[model samples]
Target: MPVFNQYYYEPLETKDVLRLVALDPATDERDPLSCTIFQCRRSAQRQEYSAISNTWDEQTPSQTLEIRCDDDISYVRITANVDALLRDFRAREKPCYLWVDAICLDQTNGEEKSQQIPLMGRIYGEAKDVRIWLGPDDRVTAKVFTLLRLLSQVLDVQPQWHMAERVVFHLNEVFCRKDGVVGLKSLLNFFSRSWFSRRWVVQEAMLAREAIVHCGRYSIALLSISLAATRFLSLDVASYPVNMAASLREPTTKRGILELLWYFHEAECRDPKDRIAALLGLVPNEKRFPLDYTAHWTELYRQVASLAFGLNDRAINFQLLRVSAPCPIQEMPSIRRGSLTGQSLGNGPYLSFLTYETQTPTSGILPHLNGGNIRFSPLTEASHGSIGIPQSAGNGVTESPT
Candidate 1:
């Protein structure tokens, strides 16, 4: 062998950037994140490791656990039993969701972690409650637990937990943050977070989208990787053709769809491809680093029928939005920036219209009148030396307000 390449390679998004794969530090060490409550068990399944990691012994062997939190924890004392820990937690009378990486995933190594990385947004997105143990030094757990409790609760239809739990999107802490369709409780208004923390700032703005939390000020790099790695093109789910009837039922308004659109937009605009990369982050000059998310967006749309929005959302008329026909990233990168207008290319409302549920974060929804094709190699490149928008008006899109 040759030595590792150190040249700076600019990725379209974040996950491409290599992040420190920090493991739980040794027990003897002053690990700031130690002492969180966790439950573990041997995994029935196994994952493979390689020389890259073996040479450095950088990771622990893969293992899975049934990490769970008990509803009753207030009764336990020091040196408590499992049931006791449960009692202790409950005695505080706090409502929280357990954020166990081992319970939620296999901590055997990187690839397994990588596959689950995309779901980070959703996991963080859906969880009504989040927390961090903060070990000895007072490390931050992203305050996921506290955020959940603060979000206003909406007493919408009681979710069929048995059914919803099947697809609870345990990954995002958000019920379907896994994309089966996670949602925030209605009436949640997080305007006060800014007073206490800087972390909650972006979380709040992204949370604002509700449909697609995590964008703009968030880690662009991580967003890129998750989109690139998503298996949307090969989505396998039940068929759900657009319901013309539902579209007319209430006229597709932004009420039920804003969150979904926000989710789509965040995923689409990510330049790199993964969450770890998001940790590394990227600069957010839209012109210098246009998001390369055609692949994931295409799949997001392709899986509409399999997602939460079925007959209820597919039917709304899209005539006013002038939404383009449905297409996949295999077709072309979506670049609306006209060559002459250059950096100032601003797309308007109809541009927001999407043929499929996830392709674009359009405020409106519409049916495709044109051919069924995939939009390949979209506006992936940041530098626009010569290319311009499609001359034909048939396939282009516009942003909501514009």
Candidate 2:
């Protein structure tokens, strides 16, 4: 066993590499939940485990505190939302293994926190399933669950019914009635919940092979949520629809880091450092940036921007120019930083620019040319370069190599 900085950790072979909790809600609602940290070796042979994706309860002051669990001496610091999530997913018939971030990782130790951030991709991707906790359910939550169920049914049988037109009609019918206003409001509330906007959950849910959203006593498939989001994108709303669409869209195709940051930057997280760390795992291996908790936020933004420029592809690097937000740090430029206010919450900057094909630039001329040739002159005499230069307008031009 060894320690890095203040964080104490053992080698994978020697220590229990995988830490989980076995949660059992007490029979009496008045009684507190029974939670014990179960340590196990991360080997080829392992038991089924589920990872919990959630938002920390930061707004509620009293919700953030150390509480006593069934485990002995040390009181674990957890939020009220986490406690509720644990109790909701408690298994009565058998023990369930869950990898919850707040408890599993050593929050007090910065080094350990750094180590765990990278492994998050694997943690969620390898889990039997990721359970997304969207806080407690109310009247709104119940309607949302019902809406998803109905939407799922419609989407499933959509092909046979028509070219998704029938599905669209039903969607409008469901959300446009007298009580539909309240239902739509409730549905909006469901999507606007902190869980959907969480940075960690964005990556966790995206990487998961399978996932489900747990709302109090009710639960629904992640697919249903995504389908419902797509349906809502058809509606003309102020901002929620666009935010919901971008938030729920699966990151199946490889995309630049800028897109990921802009899409979920509004999401909640305790650490400003996590703005980068939480989403780093979802980026492609080649484009992936380093996870350094020691660096300042401005430095981190600069590093990411510099990496984008080094790629040398205009299509990718040009996105840096598309940034529409005001920079928070005076040291960093607006192009390198995005606003956290959800100001540009539509189909992402990159997607907006890359939507269609553009004519290649020969001499920086375009569609108005009708059909013309362009040529580049060789280096000037002062540059000590000898080359042949050709110029043509209606036809192609040929140039000799230096």
Candidate 3:
């Protein structure tokens, strides 16, 4: 019946990730082995595919075109359709990674679409480059070009620089309940919770350090509070041994480095506008901190527990997460009671993120856990003097839910 809310160029899901993505391979591969976002070329050019006929009944070309806000497509005009968009991508032979929604996601396969939405980060995250398709308006595409160029300027690099290493390639923001204040904060809150989420904080910090040297500090307490929370509520020492120990002590090692990341996110993203600046490489003019965002969206989160189960077909409804604020910008996306449609990414991601952005590891980077100092030793000798878990899983720990 109705067109659902969709991201223009979202990534593929872990399970539906029909291909393995990588940079130019060693072999003579014409196309890398990864999912693509494709569409009908001719149908796009003509601007109409007779849905009622169920055939390629095309329409004569007209000067003006209509672009539907939602899938409703009820008489909105001024741009191209999905087909024309893909044609452009093919023509451009875009040097960097490109992710077109139609070609990337299986629209005909409704079963998979639902599972793919929440993993939006993986789709774009896994991409080395991204291309957005602005409908038929020359003005629209031109603005998109300008936006990309400006984004690049902020990200300023030499011409020889590779944007593929970083950048999500945003094309448009038309679908917001209102693309102004509501849109800005909705986007801010969305990226903030995710870009440096609690579970993968340690891995994210480690990745940041490895990629760019040191990353950032915080404004409101993020990591320290996270460690405290996880430590107090941790149920399994066997599965979360590193977290259990790190929660009790001050964070120093990579094992519990996540605590530090939460701090960094809060400091950088405290203001809704500042948060975007941090992501877009816009200089942080915040009074409390001054850290230029050095790296791109580094997705290092892993919920081992999610791997312990299968995906729910219901994660596609991330739209329900969008709240239509008072048609404004200064505030964040608030949870509107009875506003959205359903649940999102279904409270699990380790498997989901991997599903979309999965590139088989070729680097073989060593795991950072150090056994004696940060690693777990047999509890007997170490616990001789003070409080200890009585050998049989009684020390407030249980088998990993994972």
Candidate ordering by lDDT (highest first): 2, 3, 1
Q: What are the runs in model 1 whose C-alpha is more than 4 Å off?
A: 1-33, 36-110, 113-129, 132-259, 263-377, 383-402
Per-candidate TM equals: 0.27, 0.69, 0.22
Model 1 residue 99 lDDT? 35
Question: Cα lDDT of all candidates, in order?
Answer: 0.25, 0.57, 0.26
The Cα RMSD in angstroms, rounded to one decimal, for candidate 3 relative to the true structure is: 23.1
Displacement of residue 330 (Cα, Å) in model 1 is 24
Instruction: Please give the distance, in angstroms, between residue 42's alpha carbon in candidate 3 and its true position after superposition.
Output: 31
* Candidate 2 or 1, higher lDDT: 2
Tens-place lDDT per residue, model 3, 164-183, is 22222222333223224432
Name the lDDT value of residue 295 in candidate 2: 58
- How well does candidate 1 match the true structure in TM-score terms? 0.27
Using TM-score as the measure, what is the rank order of every candidate, best first?
2, 1, 3
